[model samples]
Target: MTLGTLTWVRALDFPELLAPSTRTAIEAWVAVDPAVADAVLVTEIDPGLADTAALTEAYALPPAASANCVLVAGRREGEERVAAAVVRATTRADVNNAVKRLLDVRKASFLPMDRAVEESGMEYGGITPLGLPGRYRVLVDARIATDDPDTGPTVIIGSGVRRSKLALPGALLARAPGVEVVDGLALG
Candidate 1:
């Protein structure tokens, strides 16, 4: 379907969505970059099914064919502010150890929803890595750029909506301003 024609299969507010912080961070990222403005597609679905399998099925997507952009927040060793990274769902982001070392934070952990929303202006269930503050380090999965001829060259990501998703070219996502391509960022 055309980008404009795309509709949100589901609708939910920030309170109902558990990931307000993720949504807020994404909003900040998108505000400065217009290219990612149309990349968000909202939808409503059971909150329990936020996982990849359920998300793909709800959207009628192929099996093992979904993108999981996880948001990790932590403080680096000398840094006073929290650092954030975005990674795919197929793999897990090493927030406690490896990530902490990379970010140089004494401790690393996921940011609470309230803090995420407060720092990021976007609502819950609508978080994407498109737009965010320059201080926030956005690490993207290199696999997101792999070409899949059968499914087309696009990566499906959350559109700040629980039930809906947005499809965009992997290259486009990588090219998004402030996005960093990291290999093996996620653990399958």
Candidate 2:
């Protein structure tokens, strides 16, 4: 179904109910341009948890056809801090070299799920790069932007639920505010 058809799953109004951190980030991105804000499409699905395999089957997607955006945080050798990075499902973030250089940290690592949830204010399978604290750098896999006749021009992303997903244009995601296009962001 088209994004417009997706149901808004939250119990409260979209603005009032979203986690504070998510709401704040979304609002700021919206302020960048009306189109960016308009792209958000929310929906409800079974809260059932699933790894990549289950998600792909439930969504009728091909193997390795999904894009996973992981949130990472850690400290550099000299500085005390936390940082975040986004990478696709097919590949892991180059934490050792590329990501460290990008984040300007001597070292970087994955943020545990609990911490990611706390900092993002978004439910675990629901986090999308569209709305994130501006502090983190958003990265997208160039391959995800390619057109596939079967899948249309959209890329499947979390629908704030484990059972369902939201599909939107990769180009749109690349253009969203706070998103930074990083070449070689993901490895096959």
Candidate 3:
């Protein structure tokens, strides 16, 4: 299916693009919010081109239309807190300051690949906020939470696996369960 300027393959055709839990979450999301029923678009991609920089360049998508999800972990008292920070590819998430304060931890750093994969049930380079555990907080940078017509209504994000990518509206993402819009969440 082609919507506007983007071409999308049906998400159901590519099981590898979705983790089992993510598929469930997406189904539930669409079921509850019929308005965003057509918000998600899936496109086949080379696993080698999974990273935002390569994916955007190869697909002719502007950097502004690409978003990256990073998993960060911090320890406070006796518990560990982890969160997913979504930011545009051009900027970095303020993990040490904004995120740490948000998580109420002394320090926050990227979670180890092994732990992130084991816990999130997602591929290392493709861990999206869609299927994160309930305990995980999802922080969306303000730039992504606010849509811009010049960049289109959608941003390309990881599809839980490297073989495909999911293009979804920023507004839809902001409305996702557990997502919090954070201003100055990313460093300019």
Candidate 4:
């Protein structure tokens, strides 16, 4: 749980520290996967430093340790489909090509910030995949979900609240709710 200039505690130990949805999801996940109990950690931080670059710089964390979750949506056959694309902070989601293809739509774009926050019930900069609605397809990039030990021991992601962040092994995060591992989900 040791990271940079931050102090991390077991996420479940302080449910009040997490967004309601995040707390519920993490609790449920832990019930089924006890192994994640200790691995899931949370640390409070200034909301102003929620951005990846700012956070890493302020906390002196490794840049690669942060992962970002972005929301993308497109309409297919008049029905709308949404996805949460997770990629390392160093890269961006392939929304124009790969995501559009996966969505089976002619176009894909980042969801509007207002709509994203309203629908997700999470703050704009703090939307994590842990508690997204079931309608959202969680897509994790291969680089972040890999079993390869050298990829990194852990990853830092949002905790469904801008005031804190969640830390856990990348492999464990890949197993969250309904994640689909896509090899080219991200563009370097």
lDDT of each: 0.57, 0.59, 0.83, 0.88
Residue 166 displacement (Å), model 4: 0.2
Q: Report lDDT (Cα) of residue 49, candidate 4.
A: 95
lDDT of 1 at 19: 50
- Evaluated against the true structure, the overall lDDT of model 1 is 0.57
Q: Please give each candidate's TM-score.
A: 0.66, 0.73, 0.92, 0.95
Query: What is the TM-score of candidate 2?
Result: 0.73
Question: Which stretches in model 4 have alpha-carbon errors above 4 Å?
Answer: 147-151
- The lDDT leader among the candidates is 4
TM-score of decoy 3: 0.92
- 40-138: candidate 1 lDDT, tens digit per residue: 434445655556676656546653345665556655445555554555555577676656766676777777877665565544454556444556777
Per candidate, the number of residue pairs that clash is 19, 1, 0, 0
lDDT of 4 by residue, 54-119 (tens): 999999988778899999999988999899999988889999998888889999999999998988
For candidate 2, write residues 60-164 as lDDT tens digits: 555444567778665666654544445555566677776767777766777788987777666787676755666766766565666544555556565433444
RMSD of each: 5.6, 4.1, 2.0, 1.5
Model 4 global lDDT (CA atoms, 0 to 1): 0.88
